[model samples]
Target chain A: SQQGEEDPQALSIQEGENATMNCSYKTSINNLQWYRQNSGRGLVHLILIRSNEREKHSGRLRVTLDTSKKSSSLLITASRAADTASYFCATVKGDSSYKLIFGSGTRLLVRP
Target chain B: DTAVSQTPKYLVTQMGNDKSIKCEQNLGHDTMYWYKQDSKKFLKIMFSYNNKELIINETVPNRFSPKSPDKAHLNLHINSLELGDSAVYFCASSQDSQPQHFGDGTRLSIL
Candidate 1:
């Protein structure tokens, strides 16, 4: 079953603009991870934020997690045309969980 | 080289036929998994194998089976495929169950 639900199913933004995606999941998770998928390809891991952590950043990506509300957000700064892809949030529940439950994903389109 | 790879990127088969999608991960991870993405783009976990042992199995039908010949390879075999079974099956791997790496996915079409 899918644990996460992302808001704004589709997002369109101009190049250099900032894109933010929100995800809400049920149940307690050990960590939440964000992934990016290009058209007709596999998903690539973006960043992971642990339940004990509030926020994390990697280059142009910033991820914030709120355990109390079971919600998380991913922000991409200075979006580029190459950033056009579907973004998904996955959760790892329980201790030493082996499987990941993914969200429906947010389709991001960056117009150059 | 691809870290996680699945064979036959695309498969079109008639309903009720049996087929298998092969997956191999060279990352030497201890865990591997299979997930199905439906037409609506909802990804759900089907199975997970750790060190050639079944760890996680969701409410998937018995028609779908995962076989791990070794720690590096996990294959999914389906029997009596149905129209509803048409979806993109992804193979993924992770070490100690952290961030996982996914394959290009196999698009299965049941006709």
Candidate 2:
């Protein structure tokens, strides 16, 4: 079953602008991870935030997790045309399951 | 070197035909997985293996069989393929609970 649901099925933003995507999950998770997939390519891990951690950052990518709300957000600062791609949120259940339940994903288009 | 690689980036065949997709990882990871992405871009786990042992098997059909000849190799074979099997299949590998590294994907189209 799918555990995560991302908001704004699609988003269009201009270069240099900031893009934000939200993800909501249904169950308790050991960790939440954000991945990016370019057109015709595989997914690349962006950042992972543990349930006990509220926020994490990698370069221009910032991720926040709120276990109380079972929600998380990914923010890309100074978006570039290369940032245009589909972003997905995946959850690892706290039950020691190795499977990753992925969301439908958010398609982001960054215009140059 | 590619951390994970899958063979036959694209596969096109008719229904009722049998086909196989092979995957290998050079990261020396203990766990490997196979996922399918539907037309709607919904990704789902099909199977997982750890140390050459099947560990996670989702509600997939029996027509789909996975084989792990060794810890670094995992292959998926489908028999009597159907049109519904047309999708992008990805192979991934990881160590324990760490993040996974995925292959580009195999775009399968069944007529």
Candidate 3:
């Protein structure tokens, strides 16, 4: 069974526009992580937000986690054509940190 | 230097054959994992090893075996491959519960 489900299966926007993707999970998690994957390539870790943390930022990327709602959001500010990729949200359950339950992923396209 | 690397970027084999994919990490991480990505791009965990000890094993078939000789290397061997076994396999490593570093993935096609 999938633990995380991402909203907006696909999103297309201009280069300067911001891209936001939301993810919702079923059970409690110890931490949530966001990753970016280019076509035909592997995933790259973007950012991670712990259960006790509300928000985290890395350069132009921002991640917010709402534990009460069991949801999280990834925001790419001032997106660029190079930012075009698939974004996935993964959760580490409170029971085990060794396994990561990944979402279906949201594909974002930034048009120049 | 590559952080996590997998050999044979692409593999095409016939059904009922045996094949292996090798993975190595230079980050000196204590934990390593193997994941499979289907055509839909949905990634799932197959196995995990910590310090050469199997820690997590999903509902994968017995034909798929993962061997970790050391903390930095984990290899996957599949016997009697089926058509449904075609998928991209990724190797990842992490320190404790931190973010994972992934390889470029090996695309396996069973004919």
Report, for every candidate in turn, its global Cα lDDT versus the true structure: 0.94, 0.96, 0.96
**Segments of candidate 3 deviating more than 4 angstroms:** none
Q: What is the Cα-based lDDT of residue A14 in candidate 1?
A: 100
Question: Across residues B37-88, which tens digit of lDDT does each residue of candidate 3 receive?
Answer: 9999999999999999999999999999999988999999999999999999
Off by over 4 Å in 2: none
Sort the candidates on TM-score, descending order: 2, 3, 1
Please, what are the lDDT tens digits per residue for candidate 2 over residues A1-112?
5789998899999999999999999999999999999999999999989999999999999999999999999999999999999999999999865889999899999999
DockQ of candidate model 3: 0.89
Q: Between the candidate structures 1 and 2, which one is better when assessed by DockQ?
A: 1
lDDT of 1 by residue, A55-91 (tens): 9999999999999999999999999999999999999
Clashing pairs in 3: none
How many clashing residue pairs appear in each of the predictions shown?
A: 0, 0, 0
**Predicted candidate 2: what Cα RMSD to the true structure?**
0.6
Give the distance in Å from residue B42's predicted Cα in candidate 3 to where it truly belongs.
Answer: 0.3
Between prediction 1 and prediction 2, the one with superior lDDT is 2
CAPRI band for model 3: high
What is the per-residue lDDT of model 3 for residues A1-112, given as tens digits with 9 covering 90 to 100? 7889998899999999999999999999999999999999999999989999999999999999999999999999999999999999999999998789999999999999
When sorted by DockQ, best at the front, the candidate numbers are 3, 1, 2
